[model samples]
Each structure stands twice: as structure tokens, then as C-alpha cells.
Target: MLLQKFKIKSMSLLTFNLLLAIWLAAVLNVPFYERMQSLTPHTGIKSSLFIAASVGVLVAAYTFLFQILNWKWTAKPIAIALVFIGGFASYAVSSLGVLITPDQIQNLMQTDISEAKDTWSWHLVVWTLGMTVLPIIAILMVKFKPEPILRQIVKKGIASVVSIAIVCSLLFVFYVDFAAIFRGNRDLKGMISPQNMIASFISYYKKKAPKENLPLVTYGTDAHRVINTSKPTQPKLMVLVVGETARAESFSLNGYTKNTNPELSKQNVISFAQVSSCGTATAVSVPCMFSGMPRKDYDERLASHREGLLDIAQRAGYKVTWIDNNSGCKGTCDRVHKFEIPAPLKQKWCDAEGECKDEVLVDSLKSYLASIPAEDKTPQLIVLHQMGSHGPAYYKRSTEQFQPFKPMCSTNAIQGCSRDELLNSYDNSIVYTDHVLNQVIQTIKDVPNYQTGFWYLSDHGESTGESGMYLHGAPYAIAPIQQTHVPMIMWFSPAWQQHNATEVSCLQQQKQALRSQDNLFPTLLSMLEIKTQVIDDKNDMLKQCATNPDGKA
Candidate 1:
């Protein structure tokens, strides 16, 4: 009876399941493999030999892991989980042709279900089943090899060590060639799927664990909005819009061929033509923009702990309010008075099965501003975070009225569509954005009481199938212009600028000057006329051109 029971606990099946995961991880990562081969230093035998050794080392190491799993109590469950990780990582790798860095993992953690929904497709569903779920079912059905638990543990542990040693020895022999290839393509290290995901998790945990304890550092406690008693102007009410996935190249104001900015172009808005984003992802850009630190000097953990521009503005006596329609301000407005539209749901801004229309933002703000006590005339800083042109479902961002472009790419997968169709879909989204901005500007005007102004900037730009790249979040250093160059526009009512002594024409002349998210913190403080030791003059783009020629107080 014991011998018969051994058939159910088949050791071969356990090893097979684990090996299957390794195989799927490697085979599905075609881009990484091809990129590695292309970067190999030499040709012919030397290259072939190096590739073989590299593959051998990887397979041998994973094989050793199988030996270790073969001895564990929950071996099957662990194996199945690893398989799923490998399969999902494959989907991610295939879609982006990019490595799964720890930062990407962090970004993934911040992504809402609505964002994740845009990534799904029939191809992904079919591939995931074939690669992961079906295999798991097969593994569960497969019989296992059973030996005495104590003996099996000892035997497998010994064999695992031996296998690991053999792999290390092989690696040592081919160390020079292997190192050269990997060093040339450092990102390829993370392309090794299930291992990459495991590494990302370990990295995220290490970074978050100790850093979470850091206390929030305050800045500009003496912050008070500067009111020029000599000029004697009304208090300012400014709207800071943080846009999503809007590339500079798509905006007509920035000289794009399309009329993507027909509505915005008609307004008295200063559209900065040469502005760049700090990061290629919202997780990086939003927080970085709010930080006093520039992108090159910024640290996510340190920035998150330190006081930021919004907090400083808050301390300065602005009745600051953050109304979010995008992914939750990336923790930028956490300390301020904030409201978030419950996503993937029907808010007033939401339509067509849960996509929030930008109009929802303008309407919501109108209602919210109306509720503010009439007695309080304190300067107000309102932030509207828009879900602008967030990809592959670009068709979903705009309403039917905004779909001027015909038969745009309605599918979530941009790669599946023709280039013209993809551009059409994206342009239509921008047209919708123009409409939203027009509404937002009009809403501020309707309020009719204070010096009203609006500043619009995107968190990051996006790749619209540019050079075969889609979506965003490539490393900033290596990212394409399409993913880094973002649209930035500012609108101030003529009366508002007149009261505050801002020269709109002067500001417009600086449109061609190079600027970035680094300008946001200092420039915004300048806009509110808040001056402090914390404000860096070098980072303020508007300072050079914002002044009237007469230098009037």
C-alpha cells in the first residue's frame, strides 16, 4: 500500500512543474533574448559558445531550485505560484519589450484596476492560460513521487547543492564572456522573468521597510501669500491642472499639424513649447514635480518624507484643495484638502462604463467651490488631476461628440491597429482634452470674484507607437522625445494678471525656452507671490519674462 501511495507523490512530476516555469519564463522573453544576442561582443564560434554557456548557467541554476522545491512540504503550491509569476511577467515583457525593474514593480503597485484594465486583451488572456493557468491545472493533476520525508529532504538538499556548485563552476569557466554580454545590457538582468519579479519584490520590500519610518520634514513654515499692499490687488484663485499622458508633439499650440488644441489655442493661454517631464511614469513625475528637488537630484523616499510645494502653499494661507480625476495625485496632495472620484464607477465625470470625462472635473469643482463659505475670501489653490489620454484605450477618454477622427483605434492594444488609426485615436483624445480645458477655464471665469488663473501641465508624455513604442515609463535618460516632451499651458484672466502685475505677453515670449518639471515648484510659488528662502530663483522659468518692462510694484 505504501509503494502504491508513492505513485501519487511522483518526484518526477514535482521537478517537471518547476522546470516548466523556468522554460516558460525563458521562452516567452523573446525580446530580451534577442537584444542580448545582438549586444554580444563577438561573432561566430565565440558568440555561439558564449550564448550556450549563458543559457546553460541559467537553466542549471533554475534546475537547482527545482531540487530544493522537491523536498518542501508545500512544494506543489509554491511551484504553481512561481509558474503564475513567470507567466504574468512574460505578458508584461512581451507587451513592453522592457525589463521588469524594481521601479516598474513600484509603478505597478500604484496602478489602479482601471489602468490595469486597459492592459488586458484576448491575446493576453489566451497566452496567460496557455502559459500559466493550464500548466497549474496540469501540475495539480499530475501524480507525485513519495519517499520517506526525512530521507527525501536530505537527498534533495545534497543534490541541490551539487547542482548549484556545477552551475557555478560552469559560470566561472565562461565568466569573461558572460560578464561582457550582461554588462553591455544591464537591463537584461531583470528580463529573466520569475527571478526578475522575485528580485523586484525583494527590492521594493527592502526600500520601503526602513524608509516608511522617516518623518515628514516641514518647509516654509513662514509661508504667507505675498499681497502687494502698494498695488492693492484682490486675492488670487489659481487652478493647477496635472494632466496625464499628454505629449507635447500632439498639441496644436506646440505646432503639431493636427488641430488637437483648437479650443485651447483660442484662449489667452501661454503654451510652453519646450517643456519636458521629470519622469516617464506618473509614479515618478507627479511626486518629483511637487518636490523642491530637480529630477537629477530627487530621491523618491526622501521627497515623500519631506514637505513639498503644495504643503508650503497650504502653510502660506491658501485654501488649497486637491480634486483628483486621475490616479490619486501620486501622493503629491496627500496632506492638503483632497477629494478623489471613485474610479471605474459612474461619477458625473464618468461615462461609457466607468471612464471619467474631463467635464466631470470642471462640474465637480463648480459645485465644490460654491459650497466654500462666502465669508472666507482667502486665496484658493485648486488642483485638478485629469485622466488625459491614458492609453491603449484612447477611444474611451473622449465622448462621442469629441470623436472627430473616424474609426479610431477602439481596441486597447495599439500594436494591433494601423499607425494612422492609432494617431487618429490619440488625436481625438487630445481634442477632448482641449474641450475639457476650455470648460475648466470657463468655470474659473464664471466664479466672478477673485483674480482667477489656471496652469496646465502633464505629469508625463506618452509614446503613441513612435518607433514601435507604445505607452509610457521608459527610463527618463533613454526615453524617446515623445515620452518626455509634455504639453504645458497657463491661462490667467486679463483682470487677474492685471491685478497681480503679471505680463501675459512677456510670459508668452518665453514659450520657446527650454523648461521642465523643475520649474513647477518655484514658478507656482512665484505665481502666488509667495517668497521664502526655500524658493530657488535658478529653477524659476517665469521670473525672467514674467515682469512688466516698467518694473512696477
Candidate 2:
């Protein structure tokens, strides 16, 4: 009866749906649309017709797949919600130049008010209005058809099939041109506004649903530091600095043309030239790096449940704490003492209500380490997670002193800038990271009581206009080199090596070998002189460089 009383025109309903698809593809997907449009200049009637024909195919396919929204009871509300969410999330990725992966969704859900405030802008508000709000209001006001369900299905299906056929025919006619365009711009598909987010979320949900809330698996429960003759008299303090988005391609220490590592290069640091990250995003990389499993065998579902480096360290009689200046340690530090960037840090170092410079991770950090109530004989493991080179506001990361490159792309809307400008902004952030690491080393030197060593490696790397891709989070199987090749540098004080019986020269030579985040677990264990049941000899880079408590080489 309700359907009969409020009947709508079939043409009106179908037209609205088609128009919605067109708007989403052509307007909401700005990054993708721009790339497609730029492929062939709007030269004459032929180019104009090509653009129209290509768009028609896309909208037709969308209409065909979206006919599910014609279902009687549930489809309308769900479709509406999807459109709304698509608009909002699309705005986020568009403004931030980050990928819309499941990890990103999780991060968005977990973001605190303080972390969100810095992301707001008038530009974002206008973009949202244009993308979804007006469209939503228009969609709601438009009359929906009361056509018979069977007829609706038949009609929409035929329309969809015909649209797809037309697209196929067109592709066959212009196969060569279309193939080259897709080949050159493979990443354009990831920029498809809300459709990309929706697809990613659905795929993520399906994979995650089965293993939701599995029991945590503990490792090294029987862990205890052995009584080694080589154990230093002074308690050890080892800092593991997990950097965000610091690619080796931008670092001078790794042979980049730019002097992005001036401070780090000056220090007695050994830079591992060839280091790969476990994953391209923090959510995957952080847990994977800490897991005992190597990247090839890593299971994302198992990562959350399994014990990581922190748990093993804590079990091995080390007082460990995870201090985060970026995303919360991605559940890698859930079992440990986790500290956010101190809320009281001044604006010079951090913005309590917004994005904080990576410097805050080390500012007065030595004093805090001194305060850790470690048992007299226990060593300390401090994990400093930095917000290094996180984009698209790369210019904000570095202070005035470190801006070696001029004319940076300062805005969060990074795609609008030239590639050189983007690289300049990204390289500036690298310099700032160098400065922060130098300061951290200085603090370690100031602490006279403990024999300290620092190991710094990025969580993952960034993609700066490489192959027309803007940020990280390409699937790991085929992620670009820029997104996987990260910078790993280490500093071992002379006192630290001598006191801990570490052979610094031997460790430096081992730096030439290929390594990954998988090495962190057993390598650090070797540095701490803690051997556990789970330690893999092949992954332990430090075993040959340092002796056990009995001092056997």
C-alpha cells in the first residue's frame, strides 16, 4: 500500500542513480579523474567524445553493479549510509594523500579528539559539501520508483548488461590506447573516491570476521636473561626508535643526492644501506616487525594474538616501555607500558592538540629513562615511535632550522603540487628526523649511569610521486621499492660496547648484509644478551658480534 500510494517514475529513479554514479566517478574521485582527463588533451571533437564515451562506460558498469540497491527492505538505507561514509572518508584520503586500507579505518575509529583537531580545515569542509552533503540532500528529495520488484530487476539487469556490452565494444575498438593508459597509470584505480574505500572495507571485513577476538598467544614465558660473564656492570639502556615514512631514497647516508642526513652522518652511526620494511603501513609493519615470524610467513590475523618483542624483553628481565609520537603502537605494545607523547610538551616540540614534531619523542627523554623504576640489576628497553615524514603536511614536520630545500609544498592537499615541490617537503622532514636522532643520541650520552645504544629504523617508507603514486600502503606483494626500502641506522656509544662486551667493529661489518624488520627481534635479543627458546639463529644479527654471559664467542 505504501508503495502504491507513493509511486515514482522508473526513468526518474534510473536517471538519478546514473547521475549519482557519474558525479562520484568524475567529481568525487578528483585525483583519478584528473589523471584520466590529462591522458589525452581536450584537442577536438574526437578527444571530447572519447572522454564522454569513457565516462559512460564507467557509469554504466556502476549502475549494473549497484542494482542491488533496488532491493525492497534493506538496500536503500544501506546504500544511503555507504554513500555518506564514502564521501566523508574520501575527503580524508584526498586531503591527506594516504591510502584507505583497513588499518586506516581502524586508525580513524581509534583517533582521539586531540589527534583529529589538527586535521580540520575550511578546505575540507567545502570539499565535503561538494562531495556528499548536497548530493545526499538531492538524493533524499528525489522520488524513488514503486516499480514491481521482478520488473525492476529485469530492467536494471538488462540496462547493466547493455552498458557493459557497449563498454566492451568501445574497448575493443580502442584497445591499444586504453591498454597503454592503464599500464602507465596502474595506481589510478586506488584513487576512485569512496568506491575504493568501500571495496577495501568489505574485503577487510570478510578476512577479519572469522578470526575476530581469538585468544592471545604468549611467547618466551619461560624467558629469563642468562647470567653471562660478559654482562656489563652498569645496567644497559637500549633505545629502539621506530620511524614513520622515512624512506632510504631520501637519506644522504643511503646515497641520495640531497643531504638529508647531515646530523646523522656526522655521528658515529652505521647506516644499513639496504633495509626493507615488513609492510607498507604502520598497522601491518609494526606488529610484523615485532613478531618472531619473517615477512614471507607473517599472518596478519595471528599478529595481534601473538607476543612480540616487548613481551619477550619484559619476560627476559628488562624494564621496557613504548613511547608513541605517532599511531598507538598498532597493538604491538598493548601488553607493555605504553606512553603517548607527553601531554605537557610545549608547542616548540609538540602540539598537545595537534600534530607534534618528532622532536618531542626525545626532548627530556633521558631524564624519563632515569626515572624508570627498574630493579637494580635489570636493563631498560625504550621504544620511541616517531612521526617521521608522515604526510601530506610534510612541511610541518621540520622546523625552520632544518628546511634545507626551498619552496616546499606546505598544504595537506599534496597532489596539487609539483613532484619536485613534494620531494622537497618530504626531504625537509628527513632532515628534521636527522636532527631528532642526533638529539636523542646526545641525551643517551648525557646519561652516565647506563651503557646505552640506539637502533633507529623506519616502520615503513613513503611514495613521493613515484609511478604517479602518492603515499604508502600499496599491497606488499607488489609494493614499489620506495615504499619498502626504509632507512635503518644505529649508534653504539664507545662506553656501551666496552661495558656490554659488544664488538662494535664486527657489528659494523655485518651492516653490509641484507636485513628486514624480522631481524629486529633476535638482533635486539642478542644486544640485550637475552636468549630465549624462540630465538632464531639466522635472524640474530648480533649473535656473532656479542658473546653470551659465559663469554663464549
Candidate 3:
């Protein structure tokens, strides 16, 4: 009875398409317009004119596309999908202050179930449902007046032509302003509703599909460990901790006001104050860091198909292992011994949601070290991938004791929380990470008959409501300092330092030198004394500071 009483009147399909397009452009694009209002220099009449032109262009563009699919069978489904996609995309852009670029789309596709749960909250549900409800209802109720197929094609063609003309005219009229805005702010194109999401997905899939058929390319095939008679005969062991979303600005060692690195500060670690990441997210950074490719020349397809640092280390007779407590190693540890936390161990450390703390990696490391054969004394290269400071569920990342910063932003709807609340939550997570790193350092220190060392480098930094940005994954060109500047810390046991003749004082003096993820591959090779033509000595961060055991540089 309610449906019958409130049924929308029938209208011609052409009229319906035009109205629907207008509704989508005007209503679903509130975030786009809001962003424009902030960015536009003009005010009053000029600003109003620009926005009107933008809306006209958008409506015509939508009309042109909708007309192509305005057939009886496909019209409703396409319209409903547009509404749904627009609703969610708008919410993400407005609430999280994220631009859904191709890299971000890849991050979404690659993310695991446990990582995905961190993004869930009632706020997303309510906002998306609210945006989609009325549009979906109107779509289901409204009737379309259908005509013959031949007539429909001609009408749709004419509409498409008119749309093209209108778009051209608007561009011609506001060419100067449009060009300036587009060139100056490349992110504006990515901020538009649904269009950005559509374009990014299409680009991501197109690039990903062809790479599946490419053959693997190996590097450093002739890699070998160089023996030094002056150095100690004991085998070497290095723990490489790949941290997630840990920003340099949050660490007390990096000059932050908060004591976020209490444990690390007490340890005999050298914290590099200036280290930039290769990319703004883990999906890109992890592979690039190990692939030995600088960010300026990084190609994901190339990196994916190539042999990396781990493969070379293993070839040099090291026991390469990847112990992951976060997401998988992003394919960097494919050929190595990859140990994911099993279900049995979850009973000891994990919550009901199957989220385990970084301590699990420490425990796993202890077990693995104990299992090493007593007679076989090969050097070890173990990578511990920690889920460090990944947000906006920052409150969940740290235990109660580590969370010295109070009144944290507990909800995933982080935008709703005050900036202080968000900072407290993020900082607390860093504190926990500091503790975890120190624990790993301690574990390595006790390993007998081996020269042990530990190295920690975060994949990327994050934004906590700074300049209206919440999380990481902004486009690399326009990414903020908070999203690119990551923390890098290292510690070597006294035996390891003496055995390799490492100049700790020289390393401390060079702490403020600028470095990046590009240094990772060469530095790791140098530390393991893995001799290969692929290892660029200039890129080796430690090579310049270290002297030979005979006091020769």
C-alpha cells in the first residue's frame, strides 16, 4: 500500500537520464565542491561562475555516459551501482581525507582480512547508508517510458554529441583557470567522486594483468660471502624488522617532545634522524626497498619479477627467514623460509579477533633460534615484519601499560575525534613498537656463538588529522612529510661490532645524514659481507663509516 501511494510518475527515458545525472553531479559531489571551494582563489561571483561551469560539465559528461547504457535492461542496475560507488567514495574522501589513486587501490586489493577489519566502524555504515538510501529508493520506484530500439540509439547519439560540445565550450571559456588548477593541484582530479575510484581501479587492473605472464628475472646470481681472516670466526646473525606506518616525527630519539621511544632510547641503538621512504604505503615500499631500486626509477612489475636482497643473501650461504606478524612480505620473501604465526600460537598472544601483538614475533624468533642445528653454523638473515603503528585503530595497537598517552581515539572513525586524542593513540602505538624493537635487540644479544645485530626501518609514515589528512597513501608527488619521513634505527651486539670492526662512533656522527630506502639493499649486502657486482658501494650507507679490522678504511 505504501509503495502504491508513493510511486513516482512515469517519465521519458531521456528526461530520466538527464535528471539522474544532475542529481549525481549536484548531490553526490558535495566533497568535490567543498574541496574546490577551499582551493579556489576567487570569491563571490567568480567562484560561483566557476562552480556552475564545473557542475554543467559534470552533468553533461554523466549524461553522455548514461545515455550509452540507457537500455531497458541495464539502466536501473548501472544507475544503482553509480549511486552506491559514489556514496562510499565520497565518504572516504571527505572523512578520511584520502585520494583513491591507483596505488591506494592496489593497497586495498592486496590488504588481508585482519587488516581490513581495522577500517570497520558504525560511522562508515551510517554515512554510506544515509547517502545511498533516498537515491536507491527513488531509483526503484521511478518508471521509465520506453521507446523502440532504433529511436533510442539515435536519441542517445545526439545527447552524447551535445555533451561533448558543452564540455568543450566550458573548457574553452575557462581554459586559463582550469589549466592552472589542474597543473597546480594534480590531486583535484583524484578528489572527484566515483570518477577517481573508477579510473584508479581500471588503471590498477590493466597494469596488474599483463605482469602475471612475465618471466622471472634474477640479479646477483654470482653472489658469495667474502671471508676476512682478521675478523672473528663466529657466524653472523641479523634481525631486519620491517615496521609498518611508523613516522619519524613521533619518535623521541628523532627530537619529538613525547617519550615514545623510552626503551629504544635506553638501548645502544643508533637512530638515523633523516631517512625518507621509497613510497607512502607498504605495498609499494616493501618491494622497492628490497628490490634495490630507487623510488624515482621504481617499477612494481620490474621489482615483482626480479631477484632481491633476500635471494642474494640466501645464495651467499645465509639462512634467510621471514617471520611475519603483519601482512605477508609483499612477495619479497617468496623463495625464503616464510613463517606466518600459526593458529596454535594465537591462543597465547592473540585477541578474540585474531589480532596478535608484535611480541609474537619475538617469541617466534626465540623458538627458531633455539631450533638452529648446533653443528651447522651458517650466517642468518631473519626479517621480522611488524604491524607497527598502523592506523586509525591505533588504540588497539598498544597494550594498556604501554598506552601512557591517555584519552585515545578508540573508534576507527578517527576524524570525529579531537587531534589530541588521535595523537595520543598514535604515539602510544609507537611506544609499544619501541618496546618490541628493544625486545628483539635483547633476544639477539643472548644468541651464543653468533655475531648478532638488529635493524628497524618503517615502510612509511602516517597523517593524524594534519592538514585534514588522516591516514597514509597519498600520491607520492603530493604526499606530505608525515607520510614520507620514516624512522630507521640499528643496533649491533659488542661481539658483532668488534668482529666486523664497525666504527660505532663514526656511525653516530653520521646520524643526521640524509638517507632513504634505496640504501637498504646495499647496506644489507655490506653488513652480511655478501660480495656481488650488484652491490653499489656508493649506496651502501655503512661502507663509508666502517674500517677494516686492520684499521684501514
Candidate 4:
């Protein structure tokens, strides 16, 4: 009789488990399985089957526990919370390519309260509440009750405990195996643990910290200070456009099908199609791009040793200005003239809903430029960091006026949107970026007594429906081409070219040479005509341009 009772209870638990599995599969979207399929060329079917089976087992176990505990009331709320928490948690954790923490959350909150407010409204409160309440109402209307067999099965605790233990063990094994696969790659390591993610973020300013504390290496032996600038005949202006979430595969300059970079292509911009990023995510790529250390050796120790590009430019006697529309994490331009806009905008640029366009940063740039004296002899380096293509709300990234492609835009998360829609939204952002770049270029061109040169590079790229991965921040080892390949372009006006013709020609020649953020420092120094004692001449792109006037094909 006891054995018969156990069998009946097990059957009821299995039914509950199956239902739970379906819910989880629908909610989480099983990103891991999708990722695995992308990695395995011919084994997609088999890999998907395994993933589905694994998810089924997990859901069954969880449901079995719910049945045994008789805490069905808690399931609705817990599942609802998990859905909402999971989305933002996934985005935040994936953005950093690591684990989520309270401190990071606090930092995000402090950086932009409006961003936090939107997250609360769109993702947390609305999404969570809706998911939780809707399902609960449906269940209540159906008058769902536990089967008598299920109740009887729960009364006998031994079977339930055994089932729970087995499920927990399986989950532990899976996690351990997954972690082991990513252990060797530092990028993967960051994706696993948010705390150990990018080692470049120095929460507190430390004067006595190691050489890597700064993002870039200095030209002088003194390390902390900039080297004396070499005298040049013409005044120089260098504008660096730091783009957000821009991938290389989408740029027409890089041979993409869509004419996304039509403006840049017309302007004789030098596009480096073969360029690869140092890191997969913005948090890792931004600091890594500025830091002297390669991605392989990038760590807290190296972070302390290097100074950022802005600091280097400042030390070289150039007035440095940083205008940003993105999160100012890692304090990259802390010592420079930094203008961060406050959240909850009162202007039309920021709507009543608190959504603001990235073009507003251009206004801030104009104000900053107007404040600078035209007669100032010191060279100037201005950084314009755009909030380009930051997504999930890809439609919000750009207005309809800039929409180059039709049938684009991801309106809802659960509504099955095609890859084309994602691409449309993303491409529209690129179109908007092109407009902004042209505006900045024109502004710099208008400056008197100064020859302007512009270079644009994205902090990192994004994944749009590639291998079922919709966004970026994958572990570097496993990251797809969409995340690592980034758009890099440079524009040199005629006046600037005439003054530094040799340097400009050299840059053009070696434009296709394999390069990463490791070369940005030396390259920038070469452009500014700053001769430092510690500069790595070999890795300097400009120096390479000077030495190898005709690039090796």
C-alpha cells in the first residue's frame, strides 16, 4: 500500500514539474542553450535537445518542491519577481559580463537617477507586477486546487526530500561544469563574477597606487605628469568620438549590406574593417581601450600603472574636455573638464516620460567649445561619448526621422520580433550617429587658428539575434563576431592634413594594419606631436605610419 501511494504521489509531482518547466522555458528563454548552439556548428539540434531536457529537469524539480512544501501561494509572487528581476539582472550582469552586486547597483543608481527611475517603471514594477498578477488572476478564476494524490504524497516527506536533493545536485554539477569551461579566459572570468570583472575600476582615488592605476602610460619618465609638448607650426584640435554599443558588422564602410555609414563614406573617412575590440562589453572594453595593457594582462595591478588618454592629453599641454551621454564608470576622465548632465530633464530634449535623445550631448559640447578662448595656443582634445544604440529599447535610441530601414523596432520583449527588426532599430541608431558625427566634424572645422582631426571608435559592439543572443557582454572567449568586431573611422580635414601630411599619410597607409586599444595611446601621442621618453614607438599607429609610409598589403 505504501509503495502504491508513493507511485501515485510521484505521478502528481511529475505533472506539476512539467507545468513549471514550461513556464520557466517561456520566461528565461534559455539563453545558454542558444549560446551553445551558436558555438557548435553542426550540433545545434543535439545541443538544443540537451538544453531543453536539462531545463525540463530543473523545472520539474522546482515544481516538485512547491508541491511537497504546500507553499503554492508563494510560487506566484516568487515566479513574478524572478521574471522581472531576471530581465534587468540579466542586462546588468551581462553589461558588466559578470555577476550582479549591490554596490554596482548603487553605482548605477547614483550615476543616473532617471535611468534608475526608468528601470523601476519599465522593467521592475510594471513587468514584474504584470507577470505576477496576470497569471495569479487566471489561476484564481480557474479555481485551481491541488490534487488529493498530491496532498497525500506531500504528507509522506521522504520521497519529496529525495527528489529535492537530486535536483539540487544536478544544478550544482551543471554550474560547476559551466564555470570550469570559462576559467582560462579572463574575459570569461569577468562574465562569471561581477566583483572580479574589469580590474580597471578604481572606486577611490589612490595617489600611491601602481603604474596601471591610470588607463594609459605617460610619455615622461616621471610617470605621473605629461611630457613637454614638441613645438608644431599649426594649432591642433583632436576630437575623439567614443561610441556606445556599435558593432563592425553593421557599418557599410566595413562592407555591410546596408548603407549605414553613407555620410562617413562620402567624407573620405578611413574605415578599418578588420579591427577587433579588446573586450566584449563597454565596461571592459572602455577601460581596456584606454589602458596600455593588452586584454590578456589587464588587471588591477596594470590598471594602477596606466593613466587614461584624457590625462595623457592634458599632461601634453592640451586642454582636455569630456562630454558624455553614457555612464561615467571607471572615472576615465575624472581629472579633465567633465560635464555630466543631471537626470529628470526639464527640456523638450528630455520628454515628460524622461526619455532624452543622445543629440543633446552635442548642445553641451557646443557650450563647452564656446567657453574656450579662440586665441589659446595649447592643443585641445575633446571627447564626445555618445549614448549610441544602447538597447532592449532600441526604438528609443533614435527617432523615426533617422529610421533608414523599414519594419524595424522591437516594441515588446515577449512579442516575437525578427532579426530584421532588431537590425532596423540598430541601423537607425547608426544613422543618427552619422548625423551627430558630421555635426561635430563641422563644428571642429569651423574653429579658427586650429586644424581639426576626428577619430571615432566604439567602446564595444552588440549582438542582435545572433545565436539567439540579442545583446552583448558575453564572455570574450565565447563572444561572437558581432560583439568583438567594431567600427573604427578617422577624418582629417585639409588644413590638418597639410600641417601633418606625413603623419596623416602614414595613418592612412597603416589604417588596415591589425590594431586594438593597445595602440590608441601611442597613436594619439603621435598625432599631438608629443614625444615622450616612455612611449612605445613600435605599437604607435602614427609612428608605424611614419616608418612604413606604404602599409604592407
Q: Which has the greatest lDDT?
A: 3
- What is the per-residue lDDT of model 3 for residues 239-357, given as tens digits with 9 covering 90 to 100? 99999999999999999999999998999898988899999999999999999787898888888889999999999999999998887888899999986566667788899977899
- Models sorted by TM-score, best on top: 3, 1, 2, 4
The C-alpha local distance difference test score for the whole of candidate 4 amounts to 0.62
Which tens-of-lDDT digit does each residue in 397-459 have in candidate 2?
Answer: 899899989889888667678878898899999999999999999889866667889999998
Flag regions of model 3 displaced more than 4 Å: 1-6, 148-158, 340-344, 545-553
- Which is the winner by lDDT between candidate 1 and candidate 2? 1
Whole-model lDDT per candidate: 0.78, 0.75, 0.87, 0.62
Residue 362 of model 1: what lDDT?
80
The TM-score obtained by model 4 is 0.70
How close is every model to the real structure, measured as TM-score?
Answer: 0.87, 0.82, 0.94, 0.70
Which lDDT value does model 3 have at 258? 94
Can you tell me which runs of candidate 2 are displaced by over 4 Å? 1-11, 25-57, 71-123, 144-193, 209-213, 230-232, 339-348, 352-354, 372-375, 499-502, 543-553
Give the winner by TM-score: 3
Residue 333, model 1: Cα distance from true site in angstroms:
2.2
- Give the alpha carbon lDDT tens digit for every residue of 2-33 in model 4: 33333322233334434544554435434334
